[model samples]
Target: MKLLRAIGHLIITIFLTALTQVGGLIWLLVLLLASKFKLKKRYLFPMVYLVFNLLLVPPVAKYFGREQLPVFDKDLKPRHYLYPLLFRNYVVPEMKTLLEQSAEHLKYQSIGITYLDANFPFLDGFPLLPHLSHSDGKKIDLSFQYVNSKHQPTDKKPSLSGYGVFALSEQNFTSNSCIENGYWQYDYSKYLTFGTINDLNFDSKNTKLLIQELLKYPSAQKLFIEPHLKQSLGLGHMDKIRFHGCQAVRHDDHIHLQIR
Candidate 1:
């Protein structure tokens, strides 16, 4: 009876270990497939469920250890780094340009940018999506930082640059009031452009100048500033240019640029 009980315990341990391996593989597969197919939005639910199970299942957690999953502290601070694809060099120069332009315009400044994912990789938890991640590459997100007169970030307005801004609801982009009522206000200090807005009104003259300058760069091939900005500069669309939707309309918080 003693021997039989020992054997039973061994079998249970082996089975649990195998299950954990399978679960880990599935989670990996989900990430691989989603990236390859660009199916993140489509597979979001299943991926979230898999992440939850990997984090919450007792046997799996014990076998793989909680530390193996994306690390979070008791206060839910992320300890793990996202894979480097999020910060490819192809995208960094454009980001720098936007940031520099924004900084030049602001007297007191704190800025954060991010992509639209739950991971919130950059800041502690502030959500902001980079425009380069969108299909068009023109939509970018930027947020103001509250700073002292000397331009130092204060506790009240923390630095969000590493993390990003988070609140991007579909309604923020699709509502009629978004543009008509200036619900999406443009900050000359932190300028961002979407593909819409072809109306060439003088109100957006400064934004047009920025777009003109951006177009002179070789990297502009990957960007799609607003239509009005392009038209104001008297430039036609290049075949390589593409446009993407701004999932959120309000540029008051973060600038959304569409690539075209």
Candidate 2:
């Protein structure tokens, strides 16, 4: 029982660390306090995690040249509250401004920008797993715009987690070729969506406009999306829009933006 419990704790630690940069440390701290004082993991976990994330991480992150994106805003917002709660929404100040300016440009058209995972606070090289380049606060993912069943634009995403739902069929030739070439992880993001709505349609026009607006910023470096989407959106001429390669998952579901 002791060995099994030790293994369980190890697994949880790794999982938490991978999901949230500081979570494993917090979990270990909870264990330490619990072992010494007979505290409950259930209550202590939330209490300590919230205290560190809410109180300690933000200001400290700012000093490291990172800023947290807002949970709610008129122009830009996170896809889910968990992003900010887990400290997965920190970015360089210029990146934040780029997103805000892009969103504001689309506000008049009634389109809102929904951002996904950015970077972990307080680390220059710590990886934000599943993304090869988000570690430095220079990269972020943005969800694609989608229309509801009624064909009206909505801020709500097809995938509740703002990932995994491919804009077009995942079985397309590019995905198939990549997977067949031993890149099974090419479409692995499909498993990460917490839940999905089946009736959403990709909003091509507004999404294209959003991309255009983002590219207008001098800080904007490049954007990653699928080839099919680039063709579908008539964005083939834009040199800034490029394929992320088979090593990375498909990007039709979202845009990967980077700044210099």
Candidate 3:
């Protein structure tokens, strides 16, 4: 099975190479659409420019002064140093400000949030695996705020695994609950095995507060959630909040916020 999977990946690599092998045209296109602030993949430039990213430079400096905002540097934090490079740039000032404010609010309340992705500094398309629409640096994916089954804030676990879009019915509803080693491991009965983090139950109230907190940002455009979850939140009729529907990953693992 491992050999077959390797063969499959090799085929995919060849296919993408051929598809994007338009050579100069593809490179030029990405350049033309390049963000004025974000340091996109320097595909054509020397790789040495990336050396600074390993230094002690502030998050904002990663953009190399293109004026991009570093929303969150999860990988740069000491405990998370070993994780993949999941941080990226946020270009909208209003969105940036709101995110800072929201993070502060969560911190003040002893709540936590783990960001997963934003625009890849490469293309404005979901060419990257596992995402369908993170292009253009306008969207962000985040682990939902968690609470004990009692709906009270709890310190986020050492690993941000098991957080995802989950049905309220799957939870044990109790006004008093204790956070165990981990909530049920994310159910891979449906989503790809990679999305095993989907079992982390979100505190409905806190998750709703998070969505509301984001909407407070003037640039907030839409919040993609499950239909049932949206209906439960009383946002089913709202214009800016839409359901990602069953056609997509259950999204119980994360929330997608897009800004204008």
Candidate 4:
């Protein structure tokens, strides 16, 4: 039983660490304190975690050259609230400025930029899992604009997680080529999308403008998206826009932006 309990703790530590960079250590601390203080483990865990994230992580992260993305900023925000709490919203100061400026440029058009998993705080090369390249604070994922069934634009994402729900073109050249080459996990994000707005359609016009605005910044290095989207959006001439390669997952659902 002692060995079994040790294994359980190890598994939880790894899982929490993978999901939230600092969570494993905090979980362990909570485990020790909860037993000593006789507090309810179930409730104490989240309460302590939330307090740590809010009071400690952000300030410490800044000292290491990573700034946490704003959770409620009107110009730029995370696709899900959990992103900030999970410490998946940290980025270099320049990258944050680039995103905010791009969003501000599109503010007149009512095109909001909703970001997804970025690098974790406190580590320069610690893998963010599922997104290996996002280890650095220079990379981030942005959700593309989508419209409801009535053809009216909405902030509501088709997928609960703002991932998956691919915006496929009539001919999915890049997607097919990647899958045909034996990369089975290429389109795996589809499963991560908890059933949400199934009828939402990709808003090409707004999404195109958003990309264009982002590319206007000199600090913007490269934007990885599927080739079909580049052709459809008429962004073929943009030098900063490039294919992410088959090694990474498809980018038809969101734009992967990186800075110099």
Best by TM-score: 4
Model 1 C-alpha lDDT per residue in residues 1-260, reported as the tens digit of each score: 98996577466544433333233334455556767878773466356545545444423323321112122321111212231112211122344454344334432322222222121112122222332243222334322223345544432222223222212223233333435556353222223222222111122333333344434545445444333333433555543333333443323232233333
Error of 3 at 146 (Å): 1.8
Top-lDDT structure, candidate number:
2
- Per-residue lDDT value at 228 in model 3: 60
**Superior candidate under lDDT, 1 versus 3:** 3
Model 4 CA deviation exceeding 4 Å by range: none
Global Cα RMSD, each model:
16.2, 1.9, 10.8, 1.3
Quote each prediction's TM-score: 0.26, 0.92, 0.57, 0.96
Q: Model 2: how far is 191 from its true place, Å? A: 1.9
TM-score quality measure for candidate 2: 0.92
Candidate-wise lDDT, in order: 0.33, 0.90, 0.50, 0.89
Q: For model 4, how does the per-residue alpha-carbon lDDT over 106-204 read when each residue is reduced to its tens digit?
A: 888999999989889888888898885998899999999989889998777888889888886555687888889998889898888876666789999
List the candidate 3 regions with Cα displacement exceeding 4 Å.
1-52, 55-94, 149-151, 155-165, 169-200
Model 1, C-alpha of 200: deviation from truth (Å): 15
